[model samples]
Target: MAISKSQQFFESLWYRKTVWWLWVFWPFHLLLKLIVWLRRSFYRIGIFKSTKLKTPVIVIGNISVGGTGKTPLAIYLIELLTSQGYKPGLISRGYGGHSEHYPLSLTQSTSASESGDEPFLIYRRTKTPVVVDPVRARGAKELEAMGCDIIICDDGLQHYALQRDIEIVVVDGNRQLGNGWLMPFGPLREPKSRLKQADHIIVNGQDMVLEPDPIQAINHHQDAIKEPITAVAAIGNPERFFKTLDGLGYQFKRQSFPDHYQFLKQDFESFSGSILMTEKDAVKCLSFADERFYFLPVSAKLSKPFLQSLMEQIKAITHES
Candidate 1:
């Protein structure tokens, strides 16, 4: 499908030609702000009840829009906690899932359209319990009943209704704080200062400039060097993924697709080099992949001190009430 006019219009505002469009979208962004404000108000005054899971809940979210690598990080967290003896569960909004009912557990065979791509992918990769619903609590409560000791919520920074013990904010290192403006006018889903509220700021990609090793790895797999290149990203800001690899001092002539673009074998033949891709893109591509294709999986690395602090926080929460 051709890019929608609104998408093109919203997208163009990120570059040097940003001035006038900011004026065009500022009102819409203001409306988003109003919604956020009211939401905060609801939670602040107890109009909205935020439930704490008996097992700790850690949220991985991006302040801006999509493609901050939330899904990959969730997979990493599941693996980390599982290795450490915690039975972790996952909760998601199921953004693209076609289901209309309350949350349901996801399985390896669940179609992306039924459970949403990211949640399905996480289910398939991690084999941890997975639930997707618009109301995060629906998913959380089910996860708790399913014997999940902890729940790691995906894309949940603004999900104030479901209480979280740890808040992790992920930003595309290249986008930093896109246009540094609010939504519509800029890329922020919430304001930039919300970063201060996060227990951790995970700058996805190599240019991370937070504290020493603000990004760390638990069991992240390294991509085997792809000399020539075959790659794809079905994500917002596909170029950011490509540029991150380039900045890592590894070069691959990567392919960029519109966010969530489906892959076909023909897309791979466009390049002769081995194929590399974000794990999200790999899901659809796998059906069409050959030996040339290798999925490069990356996971967040929490600094040791950060992880220790988070452990303490969880312990304290578990001990209280």
Candidate 2:
């Protein structure tokens, strides 16, 4: 297969030379923000009204485009809520799915082609009701009908049609609002301070150095479990994966794929030791996975006191509702 220029560009976005190009792209990015501002203004003040589902919906997504570990965080939220006794379901836009108009409920046997990779990944990992549709509210309602008490919108940060109670912004801290600009010109899907809109900001794989380190750069790998081998990822920007691996001090071979990447037999073929895969990747890899393939879980982690207070807020909402 031939490599694409977009693929090559994205892969090398971290280089110092790429940093220089942001200056050239600034004007177009300004236009991008102007367009977003106009579009969101109607939605914000209500000309483009949003509908609410009866169930409380929490949206975990990023302002920047591509994989930023929202799926792992979504799965973690499902398990956390499920364990805490709330019945949770997930709703996603089903990017790359085959169907149109009609929403699909994920089953154990759901393939990536029908449900989209992320929904199938969520369903297989969480065993929570998972629904995928462009009409996010319809999916929420379907999951609600299935007795889900709360719904998690997997990646609906920009999908303004659905109402949400808690909004989480997931970020690759390494990229940190890349070139601090918007699409086609920079990396952000929305503005950076727009993070203030999120109920919480969660950073994944936390070891990006502002100053370069020789030894650290050599071993800046993610899948290699030098510490605990439980790794998990199913997103674009595998550099985030490597950065996380560095933070955990783990050593293992990498099994990275493109954003929304579907698993292949060769991924397993490449890694030999006990595998630690992102919860998102775990879904498709589950059949071939065993005890060795332990999935690591993560969720929104604000300041300690803040998180406790937020939990109380969630509890209050649940009780009052």
Candidate 3:
């Protein structure tokens, strides 16, 4: 997971490690802003139509790059909807997957290489119907046909093509819209003003906590082997996983890769110690994982007040639909 110099440079820029040079990209950012405005306007004016599904669609996403706890929040919603006797299905863009066909349906046995890590992890964790398609609307339709009463989209805030009943934006509390500029200049994919249009905004690690489950062996069905651990993550924010491990008093060597990096067996061919990774990455490694490999699963712990309000909103939306 060695990062290229260019990637490192952008990381430094996005996190405010360097700032004075930010003005150099201001003009280009302004141009990008104009394009974004035009695109949104097209949708708003019906020039570009958004597909509305029969079931209520709840979109959990972020306006910035990098991880903001969207997947955990989506899983939380799946549990919430189910508890209310609603059958929920999930749809994703399949960011890292390359399946041979469109509208790929996911099951517990679905390969991460085909459905992508997030969708695969969600399916395994929730045991709910999940679909992946570059066309978000088409994916939602597939979920609807699967007998899902409601649909939850993992990350599709900017995907205006698929109309959503609820738009929940998850912001990284630690890096809330770094530099406040869009694209190459900063972390924001859209302007900060977009937050006002969202149905709700959840600051990750604020009202929510990622509670780790027991360590699970990747290639085995028992407890993880006790040994010095080598922590590796290919998530948008590897530091978050590493920090969680540190909080758990785990001392290990850190190895990070770009977000959604497809793992190969050869990547661990030379590793000698017990290796640990996130559940998202574990899905991709299952085909070639060994006994020494382990993964940590985490459940989202949302505040009661937030959950109550969200559930109420969900009920109101679904009732209307």
Candidate 4:
């Protein structure tokens, strides 16, 4: 699908330094801020009650519009918790999916169209139970009923309706906070001050000094095709993926699509040679994909100090409850 001109214009303004036309959206930004503040205040004062489940809930989310590795971070947490002997279940809002039912449980047979792409990817990659619902609290309840000991919310930092035990805010190291302005004027979903409230703040891809890693081995699948490949991403920030590929010394054309973009077979018909995409996008393409398509999965390699802090907090929360 073609991107709208208005969307392109605003994205440019959001990432670039302050431009004169940015003021045109200032009123809308202020309105958004008011709504956000009031909504948060209501939750805090009990006007809007937040449901707290018996099991501890850990949220991996961001304050910005685009991706900050929430899915990767969530997967990381799931693996970490499981290694620590916790049965962690995943929950998501299913952003780009529509279903006849609520709290749809995901399994290997579940299609990406039924569950959102990210949730499907998580289920496929981790083999963990995933539940999708617009009402995340309902999803969490389902997970708890399924014998999960802990819950890891994919992207719900601003979702005050479900009370969380640990809040993790993931930020893009390169794009930091994008003009530092809230929605309409910039990319932020919440004020920068909100970072202080999060139990942990993680920066994705902080170590640019790329060393030999497992990701490089995955790219070797393209060797079968002699022609140059194209790296296509239907994610929020495609540049980060491209930069990682560049750091790995791979050469390919870049094709970017809007976040959560639904893929059709025809989208790749014109392009030849191998195609690379993120795991999030790969889930949707598998039905129509072939040997020419390969996806590079990323993991959030968080610092040891951050991991220690997170483990400490989880211990305290679990002990207290």
Best by TM-score: 3
- Candidate 3 achieves a global lDDT of 0.87
The estimated TM-scores of all candidates read 0.80, 0.75, 0.96, 0.93
Deviating ranges (above 4 Å) for candidate 1: 1-9, 15-17, 48-52, 100-102, 205-228, 244-253, 264-275, 290-292
Better of 3 and 4 by lDDT: 3
| lDDT score for candidate 1 against the true structure | 0.72
Where is model 4 more than 4 Å wrong at Cα?
1-5, 207-225
Instruction: Please tell me which predicted candidate would have the highest lDDT against the true structure.
Output: 3
TM-score of 3: 0.96
Which residue runs of candidate 2 sit more than 4 Å off their true CA positions?
Answer: 1-8, 14-21, 205-234, 242-256, 262-306
Q: Model 2, residue 133: what's the lDDT?
A: 83
Error of 2 at 161 (Å): 0.9
lDDT of 4 at 95: 81
Each model's total of backbone clashes: 2, 15, 0, 0
Global lDDT scores for all candidate models: 0.72, 0.68, 0.87, 0.82
Model 3 Cα shift for residue 183 (angstroms): 1.1
Could you tell me which 10 consecutive residues in candidate 3 have the lowest summed lDDT?
A: 1-10
Clashing pairs in 1: 216-301, 217-301
lDDT of 3 by residue, 183-237 (tens): 7777778999999999899988898888999888988876845667789999878
lDDT of 1 at 247: 59
